[model samples]
Target: MIAKRLVIAGVGIAAVLGGTAVVLDQVTAGQSADSRSAPVAGSSPTASGSGADPGTADAATAAEAGGAATAEATGAAAKPAEGSASAPAGREVLPAVSPSPSGLPMPPPPAPLISLPLPATASAQGKIVDGFPADVIAFPEGTVVVSTGVSSAEGSLQISADAIAASSQASVVGHFQQILGPLKFWSEPVQAAEGQQSMRFSRGNDSVTLTTSTTGTGSTRFMLLANLHAAAGG
Candidate 1:
């Protein structure tokens, strides 16, 4: 009986050791499987971390590429628009300026009028017979006045006229001939209607008048006048 009890105890001890070895083997196999599955889970497509989807990453990359392409196209299109905006509009364009013509001659200006006042002098040929007051002699080419004060034989002599027509014709003729030799004078009498004389002389539009009258003793007196309407260019 003692031998059987000892044998039974030894079998119980062997069974317990077998069960412990089986449990340890199973535990080691489970650890190896967990280690293998951990690597697989890390490498698997569906096991991506951070909730990131592969399709979503591809879509984002495509979207970024598309946006870059669109931006490049937009930049290209905007270049011409920016260039056109910087250019002038139709109304803002300036017309071409023409240069002045070379060597063109200008017209001559008109003449200027003249006015001269002369000093008094005596007549060398005549005595103080019938003298008058201040004389105004307007030359054919200019407006000149020869004013003489009241006269005795020794004092200065004055001459009077109704306009310039009653002045001494010989003095006027001599004066004009000396001053205006370039002018053309009428040689014949210029007659108006009703036997009125309208003498005309000109030096570039200058003119003159002449008239004669008989005194009571058959003495004749002549008057001369000039219109200096054209001496305006001097």
Candidate 2:
């Protein structure tokens, strides 16, 4: 009885071991087949993680990572450059300052131009003199008479000539003094050359002036002024 029992138990043990081996072989075969059919690394990913193959999930993960990297690259390319973002659109940048061509600082603008005024063509007093004691001075013969008119109204007269003689000037002065003779005519001293003289004489309501000066070529210039005020209530 003991021997039979031992033989049966041994057979049962063998059967169990054989079945376990077969089960293990089948599981290994199934795993190999699944591996062969599984998605490769770097393939598209699945939406779901549950029950997903590690290889497939890994491929999906790698693909996602690569896509993110590619997206980053593309965005970097599209983004504006550092200075471009700050620059104004459609406008060119100009230099803040321009240098002088001479390389020195630009000269201050030229000082405002100014000019002196010239005298008018005609004399200011309008040649107002007359009855000039030609006896006092006379122009040299043939001296060009550029102008030959004297003007007077009331008690004033002026005369001018382009050329004259000093001797004639002295003679005329002596004659005038002799003719004026001593009538209480108050006189005002006036500066004059040796042969030329100016005097103003006043007597109550009457006054007279004898004035003279000479310029280039001894052009004789003289003025005579006389005022005989009406006697009181006359």
Candidate 3:
């Protein structure tokens, strides 16, 4: 007989195994779990693993899967679900695989983030992006605002700034930092071109992304993205 113990995220106390629904006790972040059940006894044993009866094979498979889950739920990085019984107890839970309407596994929720890499750089001699300027600069054409347009259901706010001039990636980023004081940078601006770079910044749920590029027309382009919804920890 095999006893199955499982560790899971808060409010996620069960799992689907071999078409069977197995319920485990709720576990707190970093807490031990209590969920064990002996597998169904199989038919007469065979020569080896290859000849094991279907029941025995199923049991062994489930046991291995359960063990892996236990390891994940017991990790230090596990976050607790909100409003759970363990909330007051300082227990965290990690997101777990959820079943979709088709009975298939759904992807876990996205973690909060600030930004990603830069978009393509076009013409440097173009109109200026408005409403979000870290500082004033001389651009032959002007600056325009743009964003990567991250998708979100809760809606989002965008504040962008762009420029069309000659400027180094570092200088543009430095200027933005001056305007957005008290901001926390998540990643350094990675230069995609001699005059183009992208970086991520955050303050709680608020996020600021800076992207700069040079257009083929001898222009410098800069954009600043500020999303309030994302800042709220989307």
Candidate 4:
């Protein structure tokens, strides 16, 4: 009977040992599964704890893109616009020019001057030249002839007389104009000297020029020059 009791005890003990080994194997498998699911060292964790979060990744990408866009906009704003010009700093700006008036009339330009060479003839104080055109161009009244010359060559006659009159410049110039106006003599443009007056008359290849100036004696000194076609007059 004692042997039989001993065998039963041994069977019970073996069964308990086998049950404990099975329990230990189950616990070891659970711990290995937990270790596998946990995050590695120095690695970031996500919401699911398995991988990265899609929403958070998208937000980061969007923030980076927005920052780049803002930087580009700021850089563009710093540059100058197209078709615009800018002067340097601390420089002066010139004033805009205005157009001239369109209504008023402008004065005519002054006429060109005429110059003549002096004659080499000795003349008396009161006698006229031999070939002077006395009928066509008369001298001023009471003119005391100082010098006179006449030249007839090259189909043209030229006479020059220098004289003094006890009259004003206006009187001497008017005397010739009154006498020559009836003969179709028109006035030409001339430039006179200071304190002096001059006139030129033109008709049919003929010209008469007179220059009169004031003398210290309150009298007028005058010079007369005539150029005429030789066939026209003496």
Order candidates by TM-score, high to low: 4, 3, 1, 2
What global local distance difference test value does model 1 have? Answer: 0.48
Residues 122-164 of candidate 3 have per-residue lDDT tens digits of: 2223343332222322223234433323233343445444544
lDDT of model 2, residue 146? 39
List RMSD in Å for every model shown: 16.3, 21.6, 42.1, 13.6
How well is each residue in 1-234 modelled by candidate 2, as lDDT tens digits?
999999999999999999999999999999999987776664444523265766777788899999999999999998888766345788978767966587668543322111123111232232212433343334344333333333333333333433233434445444446655454445675776676677766555455566666656655554454543222211
Model 3 lDDT on a 0 to 1 scale: 0.50
Misplaced by over 4 Å in model 4 are: 1-126, 231-234
Superior by lDDT: candidate 2 or candidate 4 = 4
Off by over 4 Å in 2: 1-168, 191-196, 215-219, 232-234
- The residue pairs in collision within model 1 are 110-233, 111-232, 111-233, 112-231, 112-232, 112-233, 112-234, 113-232
How would you encode candidate 4's per-residue C-alpha lDDT over 143-204 as one tens digit per residue?
88888877755566678888999999888888888998887678864898888788999876
TM-score of every candidate: 0.26, 0.26, 0.31, 0.45
Query: In candidate 1, which residue ranges exceed 4 Å CA deviation?
Result: 1-47, 80-85, 88-234
**Candidate 1, 126-231: lDDT as tens digits:** 2221233222333333223232222222222233332232344455455545544443443435665452343445444444555544335443344454444323
How much is 226 displaced in model 2, in angstroms? Answer: 2.0
lDDT of each: 0.48, 0.53, 0.50, 0.77
Candidate 4 has which clashing residue pairs, if any?
A: none
Q: Candidate 2: lDDT of 174?
A: 49
Q: Pick the candidate with the highest lDDT.
A: 4
Candidate with better TM-score, 2 vs 3: 3
Tell me which of candidates 1 and 2 scores higher on lDDT: 2
